[model samples]
Target chain A: MVLDFYFDFASGYSYFAARRIEWLAAAHGAKVRWHPVLLPALTQVTGVLPSPVVPVKWAYVTRDMQRTAQEEAIPFNPSPAFPQMLIAPGRAMLWVRANHGEEVAVSFARTCFQAYYADAVDIADKAVLLGIAEGLGIDGSAFLAGMEDPAIKSQFKEGNERALAQGVFGVPFVIAEGEPFWGYDRFGNLERWLAAARKVA
Target chain B: MVLDFYFDFASGYSYFAARRIEWLAAAHGAKVRWHPVLLPALTQVTGVLPSPVVPVKWAYVTRDMQRTAQEEAIPFNPSPAFPQMLIAPGRAMLWVRANHGEEVAVSFARTCFQAYYADAVDIADKAVLLGIAEGLGIDGSAFLAGMEDPAIKSQFKEGNERALAQGVFGVPFVIAEGEPFWGYDRFGNLERWLAAARKVA
Candidate 1:
């Protein structure tokens, strides 16, 4: 079964999951479909206040993300200016997925996540995004054009609607065999479920 | 180092953590302090919306709780009327801790958690709590009186205030070496922290 991995560019935990999911999926011989959705769009549907907006959880998450990153040995240094406008990167990811293949899209998503969370770059800026795309061998100008394409924007919006419809309320949400797992912490549970399903298969 | 476990009687994850924490602490030669807090009070301080109030998250939690409980081999069948008022059980737990020893209070807390989560009994009702106490060989009438004692009620309020001041926004929150780990999923992190602290010691 294919695993649907939903993430938003602004989420640190999503960045953590992005770094590990591919390997985990490979180990289980599972294919992963990365869907980048606009997190703010989900507020109307999920009624979830952004974690950064909630003071106590925000503090806990900041500490937890640092500790978790260190534990996983992943490079993580989130920009102080967090909860950056993810719309541009979100659309860019979908644009790459539509034009270039899934592998290229995955690479693009990872770069955006790393740029924002690990490198502390301003991902919301068009210049920074173009730089990221150009570094990946994708023509900067064309990538910018694609990001602004109405069709690509429509697809991004559709992706958010689809995520809401699929009961996704948070980033790093994983769905396997129609069962939903929310958060990177549930990755272990997802791994077990995948193994169990593989054995049954 | 001692591990401080902050829990709420109505929290399913707290029940999951409650069942395993003592043993986990003992394995590492760590002492555990069980602090039962009123979750609603922390909400006022943290401005975090209750999980159940967020529809999609609430649905995920229902499934996650069941799956986690099964994985942990803990009997869990949440009461149909969940988010039950935890005040009575909260007060009773403090009473047990005040009169009896810490071990007895831990036992009383476990029973209360099991009564609500595993047995699907209404922990909000004083009669049900008294029955649980009587079954545990505690003086049922005296337990009832303690639950209602003005001093005990004041202590319970103090406990909630203490939890708020400590920056507790969720259940199954663990603190060790001044680091806070929230949720049952963070137990692994807590273990690692304990191990590292021991090495330094």
Candidate 2:
């Protein structure tokens, strides 16, 4: 079966989930599909301030991300330009997916997350998005225009809508078969659930 | 090291943590100190609605708790009368602690959590709180009075303030030495952190 990983470039937990999902999917013999969703839209629908805007949750997540990262030995430094949408990077990845295919699209997604989280770069900036695209050998000036392409923008919107329709209300949401699991913390629960099916098979 | 468990009787995840922590602590050769905190008060200070009031979270939490509970095989049937505080029960436990001892207080807290989550009882009810007290061999008539005792009320308030001072903004918040961990999901992390210290010692 396939595991659908719905993530946002702005989410620190999603960064970790991306770093971890490859191995976990490999272990279970499942293909991973990365779908980027806009976190603000989901949070707006939930009628609560997004975690970063809420003082308590911001304080908790900043520390939680660092603590969990340190424990897992993952390279982490939350972006100085955090809480900003990576819409430009998101659209760029969508264009890459359409032309280059899933492997490169997934690579673009991972690099965007690494840029924002690991390298503390502004993934939302047009130059930074172009830099990431060129790093993946996608030509720069054309890729810059493609990030604003109407077709790719619609595709990004569609991905977010589809993720919401699949019952994803937060970042780092994963679906194995059709069962949805939210949070990096629930990764173990997700693995165990998958294992039960494996044992039965 | 002492693991301070900050919990509320209203929380289903706290119920699971209460069940799981004992063995985790025993395995690590650490002591657990249970601290009851008023969830609403903590949430109020956070300037956000509690999970039960947020539709997305309320939906996720209900499903997440059930999914987690089923995987772990814990006895759970979230209180039909959930989203209600167990204030009387909280005070009663404080009274039990003052009168009986920590052992009895811990037992009282566990029973209240079980009564709320497993049995679907309204733990906020005075008679229910009294029944729970008497079930544990405490005198029902005197215990009912003790639940509202001025000293017990103030002690409960003091306990909540102390939890806030320690940066507890959510249920199942635990502190191992000076490091704080939140949520039932973080139990493994807490255990791993404790294990590191154990090895060094």
Highest-lDDT candidate: 1
Off by over 4 Å in 2: none
lDDT of residue A27 for candidate 2: 91
lDDT of 2 by residue, A1-201 (tens): 799998888788899999989889889888898888888767665665677766766787788888899988999876788876667777887899988899999999988888888888888788888888899899888888787789988998988888777777888999888777899998998889888878888
Model 2 score (lDDT): 0.84
Residue by residue across A16-69, what tens digits does model 1's lDDT show? 899989999998999999999877787666556688877788898889998998
Candidate 1: residue B30 lDDT (0-100): 89
lDDT of 2 by residue, B99-154 (tens): 88999989898888888888888888888888878888898888877877898999
Candidate DockQ scores, in order: 0.61, 0.51
lDDT of 1 by residue, B1-201 (tens): 688889988888899999889988998898899988888787765555678887788888889998997887889876787966578888898888888878888888888888788888888888888887787788987898898999999998887788777888778899886899999999999888888888988
- Alpha-carbon TM-score of each model against the true structure: 0.95, 0.92
